[model samples]
Target: MALLDTLHRWAGGFVGLVLALLGLTGAILVHRDAWIMLPHAGDAQIQSTHVLAATTERLMSNPETRPQSVTFANANLGLDRLDFGKGAGAYTEQAGTIVSQWQTQWARPELWLFDLHHHLLSGDTGETIIGIAGVAGLFFVITGTILWWRTRKTFAFRPLPKRLSRPAIVRHHRDLGIVAAPLLVLSLLTGATLVFRPISAVFLGPGAPATIDTALQAPKGPKVALADHLDWRRMIVTARARFPDAELRSLSLPRKESGLVTIRMKRPQEWLPNGRTTLWFAADDGRLIGARDAASLSNVVAAYNILYPLHAAKVGGLGYRLVMTLSGLTLGLLGTLSVWSFWFKRPRPVKVRRGVRP
Candidate 1:
């Protein structure tokens, strides 16, 4: 019992700030589509696949700013996204004119918060640290629940403690931590697994491949110049013909001279809104060169895919978003209060009956 108490306090005290930051950032990200507020160009009336393809191809024609990828605007959102490079993205109308630039966190709070949450402002190294923090968060949750079990009879849900005293705060921390343990564990475990993908194999099964790395290389064909007009309509038609049941989602144009055009799609049965299935086309002639179907994924890989949407609450619309939001808030509050209780608050000494004793 003492060991559990010491472990919980030390872990919470050391990583509480990071966990709180992650929770706060995650809460903000849950409503990203609503808050970013990228100006919509009014919905396009024409919804032809060919027109959509043409719009994207036209956008890539610009030599000064070649896009790395282009995400089509949702009918409701009214603008597509053009990613020029890392940390550089712009919203555009169906015609592909710039509506807004969201390369920096200051300009786009959601994107900045997203990078901070996922990458910790330090790229892969930071992600590894955040991943470790997530594991630590899981530890806290498990240990906290065990500790709370000892005083389960006294559990009471309260918005805040009855008083500003140390004892009052401790009670709030204990009760709230216990209440939020399950959710915190889920969020932390999922988020951590995403960062450290290798951890996924443990749950997936021993020896399961944790990643699938595919790249588009230069094919044996006449090299196409950037100025050469691309048959945009043909590419879309080819992709549809190949995957009739899949919904077209986004397209990534090759950044390098030998790069291939990659398309992302969502099948009907997929839980992820963006879809994991991908197809690559030769940039020179729009020939289908490579493909990965969601339906054909292995059990381990398929199981791993579910974790992302689950952690992000991307499946159940607004209701699930609210649940995730509450979970995040609970974690932030629990971590903050626990840290305060452990480090800052001092135990109050009992008053003596001075009138009789001295």
Candidate 2:
């Protein structure tokens, strides 16, 4: 009880409010990718490698925008995301019209939201403030647990008050806080991982994590002339023949002489945003070179990979995603209720008799 009160007191009014706001936003954003990935946007088949090559040629050869990067999207409404060096390009899955992109400092709405979540969308200051907020959240959760522990004997999840005389806001605050404490803790802890990555890296051994990043970012080895190409259809055929069970999510064409054509395939039973099998091809000759097994990643890298998808519930499918989203919202609500309870429902000081009380 002392710890809970102390933690609550230490949380202050404004900081707690901010954390709650962040949690609320994060809860909303948590399942966005899953929702966005659904068929709501528009239909465009994930183009074949040859077809993609031809499209690239056509788009580039067209009098308009030049191709910058091709982002292969998975599923329907998941037309490949093509980036042009110029700010104006097109999202084929989203109406096939040329769109000029804008973000806080990045180039997309998603990035803007992400920046808002982590950095309060203010760049470095937002990042630092949010990082501090996460650390504070961890503190509050631990202290709250310690306090909640002392009162376990009387703990009950009574969200609605039976008494008609009780104030509604205070009741709402207390009950909501009681029910959502666990979820708030979870949302905070998972989010903190992004800021404090080194906490888990200690277990991954020396230099192994850096190695994994390098491997995942392996270069497109030795680019050949774009004039003669295998094209998208054949490329897809070749990749399918090579890895039968893999789902093609992305394909990055080589940009330079040393570039390699990279095919990223989805992994089985994984929750984070990672593909177990990454097949690299000599961009010029379609030669298969090095492959990365996601299952075999160093503990540090694997841990990092699992965090985002788990945070967003993407790796866990619909049910898991729902659970995560609800958890975040619950936490936010709980945090808000907690502060309200403390602010409005604290016990009144004892009254003294008129004169001879001393």
Candidate 3:
């Protein structure tokens, strides 16, 4: 118990507070896409890539706007983000550029929610601080697990005591911590992985015939325009034929001046938001290039790769979302309880009336 108290005291602080906030925000971020205001989902038959290409070309011609990116959804729906001027951008889903923009801020409700998680919208400082907090939280959770081990048999869900006393603080501290410990461990460990990629990369190496080291080394194909050799339409046709039930997922326009265009698959029966199989194509002449299969990855690496999508509840749909949301609230409760326990332990000034005896 003495040892547990020491560890707990060291673990709870401002860094813990930041981590608590980051975790709370992170949980909400998991289902953000479903909640954030965006244009409606698209139809079954999305338009051809070439058609979007024409619109992109026209949008580019206007000097008033410079295309930052053009994303394909489907025939009736798509998203275009443009650099109108400065750091500003507009989102256009329907054909012909409509000026719909969101200000980049920390307090814009949903965007603020995002800011609270990533940057506190404080830019790099907040990001770095949050990253450090995640590390602290990892330490806290691990230490907590060790502490809980001592009280394992006696553990049961119990609320804090009504009175302010040493025993009351102890009960509140122990019981609440025990109840939320499992989720704390999960949320913190995953949160830590998101902040520290190297940690994740290392964890991804344990259970495989070959390490994630091999997976990360996937060939950096010589620079070539992926669009040139592949036809986006034909690639789509082949992909649809291959995974007929799959919906049109996000597309990655060719990155290499000489690389291929990439498209992902989202299946109807599956909860995977983005297909793991990326179909690569020649960007210039539109030819089927290659399909990179994630399933082929060693079990070790595949487990590591699931961190983000799982944490964000982006993988398993509503069920996962509910778990994530509840986990987040639990973390928030843990933070408040820890802080409250600390405050309750501190000595308070005794009440004294002017004529009262000492």
Candidate whose lDDT is highest:
1
Residue 125 error, candidate 2, Å: 4.1
Instruction: Please report, as a residue range, the 10-residue window in candidate 2 with the lowest summed lDDT.
Output: 95-104
Q: Which ten residues in a row have the lowest lDDT in candidate 3?
A: 225-234
Q: For model 3, how big is the CA root-mean-square deviation?
A: 6.0
Better of 2 and 3 by TM-score: 3
TM-score (all chains, Cα) for each model: 0.87, 0.68, 0.69
| lDDT of candidate 2 at residue 264, scale 0 to 100 | 71
Better of 1 and 3 by lDDT: 1
Model 3 per-residue lDDT tens digits across residues 1-358: 6876576665674455666676678777766544535554332344454554454455544434434344445322345444333334455653435446754543235456876787776778887777677677666666766776877786666554556565565565566666676766677666667665666655554334245556634344436643222333455577666665666564555553636556676554333446565666565655566765665656666676666666667655578678878778766656665666666566578988898797
Tell me the deviation in Å of residue 345 in model 2. 7.7
lDDT of 2 by residue, 289-309 (tens): 677766677656776676666
Report lDDT per candidate.
0.76, 0.59, 0.59
- The local distance difference test score of model 2 is 0.59
